[model samples]
Target: MAGTDAAPADSATTGPVDRAAWVALAGCLLGLFMQMLDTTIVNIALPDLTTDLRASTSEQLLVLSVYTLAFACTLLTAATLGGRLGRRRVFVTAILAFTVSSLLCGVSQGPVELIVFRGAQGVSAALMSAQTLALIAALFPKARHGLVFGIYGAVAGLAAMLGPVVGGVLVTSDVLGWGWRTIFFVNFPLGVIACGLAWRRLPQLREQPPPRLDLRGMALSTAGLFFLLYPLAVGREQGWPPRLWVMMGASAVLLVLFVVLERRLLARGGAPLLRMDLFGSRRFTVGLSLSLLFFSVFAAFFFTVSISAQFGLGYSPLRTGLLALPFAVGGVLGSVLSPGVVDRIGSARTLCAGALVLGAGLAWVGLTLQPISGTMSIPAVIAPLVVGGIGTGLFVAPLQTAILSDTSEANIGSASGCVPTVQQIGASIGLAVVSLFFFGQVATQAHSAVPATRAELVADLQNTAVEPLFRAPMADRFADCARNQLTSAHPDRPAPGCDGDPSAQSGMAADLIGKANGQLQEAGRAVAARSFVGAFQTTLWALAAMCAAIAVLTLALGSRPGPNKPE
Candidate 1:
């Protein structure tokens, strides 16, 4: 989910190659591109959907969390299914599912319906994700594996960078007045083309019979993940009620049951989806934890920044996307240049450098936002973003490599499946947790901000020469009314106040009321902006500290996985 975290180190045993192989690679990577593209594209549409659908902040969080939760829950199952059914057969089927789900998403009328469809799309994406590596393993001989993987990584990086821009264009243009719907509809053509190419070009390997799926394990895992994620996603928004706490406890118990069952099953000579032994190695544990921590922070970064740009500052979707472009560019360049850096100084150094750079960039952005109380210009956002992105490219690619480098080849399938799950879980948790902090800050700041804002407006008004002539008492009364109006459910629409009072129907009184309302709106906007600035700065600094922790962790990473290879 966080680019390249779950990439399979499938060192394929291959003998031959042809044009078919290249085409197959193209088709597989296209699927990869589409999958990654949706991840970023969805973020761009969040603010739009929030405004248009009258969605609560909680519901908006659900829109993002459901997809990731579903994807994480299904990765291991989907990976095994692809192996059992044959990767190409499963891959094409997933494309069909993804296409249909995209349709369902585009036409969705409400947040719940849209969230459900997004989960379906996530399930489909999980299926397709497994095949990206599987197809490459099946089609390309060992000789061309690196080349294909390079292409694959490039496509993923490009998609991540391009998603915002594309979403912005579609949303801004409101193609056919589709508004945010165009973002999903755009997936239709890509899914169709990818499906066609996959069906025709990908090889049909005679897959050996796969082991039986652990249905019980799947059930427990699904329920467990759901229980854990649901509470986190909604709890803060709901003020962390007792029911959620009970659910969290159930989630823990269910997951503990899963681990117990998996261990027992492994001892009994039955297959378990995840091998517990994989975590026995210190290096594997440390590296994967570090990777998970890094990814969570990475994912939370975009969500927070997107809200800051679109909701806080009132930037158009297109402009927000453009603001994110430099980050993506740096990400691509970092991915491109990282391999050389790794080859020279080793992965540990590369990871440390990346984490440090990312932390610094985030800190820089936080500093810039602090002065403005979270309000920012395009240049102010982009300059640091470029640095942060390069850090992302540097950190992400190498982190995946280092984490996988710690595990054995036999574990690659499980590791690949687990990697994304961890990344997604980290991302999902980070987003939910950070949103709690962010909104809490916003609410607290806004509470005090409202009165202060009104006072400032009144102070300014008192000093004006014409303030007394404009029915000063009426001005003060309307100002109080306007403050209440500013806090209405629908802030954009004009609301009834003194103007609606029959007793205040005098033309002079109406004019005074209109002036007060206009003044109040301006004051409200300024307060909202500053509150966002404070909240965003707080969240950003917290994330930077997280990054710095990861940087410190790199120093403790044991030598690569080979020294403690699995038995």
Candidate 2:
């Protein structure tokens, strides 16, 4: 918790919640905002990145996963560092690191470069974010803690939901034609100013006599998560080779070892990496699981929808954003309404209702996409997305209340710390699992599109007023070429002059081929669209399964709500 052991300005001169404290709080929120913004910003940009960077499906997934993976890995270590070196000092340094990395990310020339820099940004984000809560705990008086935390909650909620809308606006506007780079570049000024404000306004926090960091514990934990996630992110691309299996096994073993090591440390009278006892609470464990499960689906849903909209349907970035606007709007309403829902029913029932609603909405979206031959309409997309959003809010809005409602005060700091960790890790895991299905379907549907396209090509050729001999060969040739281009979201441009058929009319061969090409391309797009739609359907089912699990787990949480907890 970023060295909570420290005294904040001795609490003598400034008293609690001073002007400087408020400024510090604002700086921390800005820092939090940036991190949250980056998380959502990339979802909309994925399609653009996929095309512009020539990045493979796996690589594109990696770009999204790497940041979260790095963020999760570094969290314990960053928080520990904040404890030892002073939270404010470490937080400021991280801000500088985050800013510089954002600059590098903006100028990146290739996908590989972008991935590496994003990891750097994630690390900085971890260090910077770890301290914000600690600062809040230090600055806010007990009387006002709930209020400040409420504001924090509000910011976190908005940040989580607003990313796609902002990303759509940014990418659509192109902001000086900078394209996706503008998203990262937009961070530079905000980050710099936040850093300055933080350094000037934030107080230094030093643990009395300082604390020793468990480097061994940190390494074991990091290795375990890395091994676990690496294969998930890359395994599909490499066809899940033997080495990947080895990595997965090693990851499990390492995680087991981490658990053993933490237990031994706690038994001995030394600080452990993460407190093992936190898992002892049945409510905490179940709540953590539910949080992870929900967000995992949450993260993948946006990416899946974004790709479906842009690649599958041929919508501009702006149109894609507009369709999704309803989802975001609905989420806001859901967040506002979730408390009453929980109050009217119970946390468990509220959660269950939300999950089921989300599932139904997602099913609607999938069925809606099934009939789509090309380009999904905004009206069709809006209703289901908005319904799904409300369900998402219903599930999301009550998560913390159900989980932390039973948490002890001593564990509150740690509980607060674990929330995002669990959510992000779940997201990382969900995206990896979904990618396996999503990309696999893309390949499957692309291949499946060939025959449908070939038939359409033959019909188009027959109606073209072209000769039968030329038409037959031309359709066959176009089918072969079109099939080859199915892996791409777009169709390959057709070259003039068909092979064979010497008696064909001048330009007639080209014209017939062109007509076939348009359908063929549409067929490819339809396949890509259909594949994405298919994946989303399965993802929704998976999400429903998770919701069911949540309902079951809710049985474990104590029904009583805390005084500070939301209904």
Candidate 3:
């Protein structure tokens, strides 16, 4: 059922040099753009989805996590199917699936429906992702691959940057009453066009003799990834109950079984979807580790910063999205320099330098968060982000190249899918883990600092525990409190007779009313500021640890893979 049994349909490899190649490239790039953009686009739109769908915080997390889970699980199979069924066929099918699913996502009436549709989109994404690099490799001659890859990297960086912008514009706009749905609905035309172009222009290479699909391995991997991801995604929201523990246990068992299954498949002369032999190459292994760690760092950064910008700093989604532009700018600079740095300084050194810069950026972000608030200066925050952007730009392409360097050209699809899959898994884990740290910090701080006598403290704790629910209102309150409390020189000072409750003083004295209200508000604001600062500091420390670990792993990347050398 799995392997390609016959040569690819024998179409001429080269046709008249015309607009065909150009069309093909554009289509592929469009497909790539949609795929990558979807990964982050939903992030900015979560607030809208929550309001429309009446979804809980946990449900929104499922919406994001499920897509990633499905993508990660199916990637290996998708890669194999591309080779066996014909890359163009698989590519078109994927685009159509993604397009249709996206439409479903937009039309969905509830969280469950939206999540299901998103999962379908993820499946479509996996299929398309499997073939992109292979298609690119087939389209360009060997000598031109470096340039092709460079262009591809740039496209990816652009898509990532554009996601927030697209989401922000769509959500802020009133046209068609689109709101968040515009983000999903917009993909329809692009996907259809890409599918059409791919069907017509893609070259047909002779397929090799049929290879076998490892169904057992596929099942094991899927089950294992789901198991691992489910807990990471949902545990924080649900407070890691015993039932969740069972799922986590199951994931561990299944993963071990998956590894064992893969080994057995390799021993049986079956082309195990993943060549276990690849890991023997130290560079490839290290590269993968760095990929996982680096992506985890980025995931934590984006998640934390997104929440902080809106929640801590009280910025609009549009403004926050605009503020994030510097990361992309940095990425562009990094991409521009990747080739030169790789050629001159060597890929390893360039990557390490990027990591160091990223570490510094994170350290700056951590150190600079102020208890006082005047909308954290745009340039001050962007400075660190630019560092991260440049570092990521340096790291992504070369790291990928190094990881895949040792992979047999035949299994390049596998390596391509594998690397991104690992990165996404790291991302999902980081999001979940960091959320746990963030909310946990909030809860812990609330418990320790908030007073037992204040009924409001209970609400605050619950709010902190489920703070992800406070899309805007609670965040605004928190920010207002911090701003007023930090800047106010005499928050608790009463106006003349302000000491007594306004209700008690109502019949007796008008002047006491204002004073009493002011005193209570001041007290409340002080409590909130302390709690907010505690949560803020705690989350920063957690992010710092994650980033620092990534920095260490980045330092471990020994060297770049020689061109065409297996990692």
Q: Name the top lDDT candidate.
A: 1
Please give the range of 10 consecutive residues that has the lowest summed lDDT in model 2. 491-500
TM-scores, one per candidate: 0.84, 0.83, 0.80
Roughly what TM-score does model 2 have, to 2 decimal places? 0.83
Candidate 1: the clashing residue pairs are 373-533, 374-533
Could you give candidate 2's per-residue lDDT for residues 1-567 as a string of tens digits? 223455454432334466877877888888888888888788778878778889876678778778877887787777667766877888889988998999998888899999999999999998887777666666755544434554565466567667777777888888888898888998898888888677756656655566578888889878888888777766655677899899889989988998899889888966676777788877678878877877777777776777666766767776766666788777767767776676677667777777777777776776666623543556776788788878877777666556654444333434545666777778778777776666565656656565665666677666655667776676677656555544433322222442323335457655654545555455455555655555556666666676666556667665654334543
Across 1-567, the per-residue lDDT of candidate 1 in tens digits comes to: 011222223334445566656766777878888887888898878877877778776788789777877887788777667655666677889999998999999998888899899999999998888656545654654544434544565566568678888888898898999999999998899988887677767654323446678788888887888788778767755777899999889999999999998888878876677767778766567777886798678767877777766666777889888877888888888778776666666667778888888888888888877423436766676778888888887777666556554454345556656766776777778877787677666665566565566567676565444356554454456445544443443232234752344346667655554555556456555666766677778888899899889988987765542212311
Quickly count the clashes in candidate 1: 2
Estimate, for each residue in 1-567, the C-alpha lDDT of model 3 and write its tens digit.
112232222211332334665677678888989988998889888887899999976688788778888887888778877777777778888999999999999999999999999999999999888777767666655444555666776777668676787788788884589788999999999998887777767754324665777788778778878888778877765667898889879989988887888788878877777767778777678888887877777777677666656654555778767756888888888878887777776666766767776666666766665543313556676787787678778776566656655555555656766776787788887787777666555445444333421434334434333333432333344334433432332222222333335565554243423433443454455444444445555665666566566656655666555444422
lDDT of 1 at 151: 54
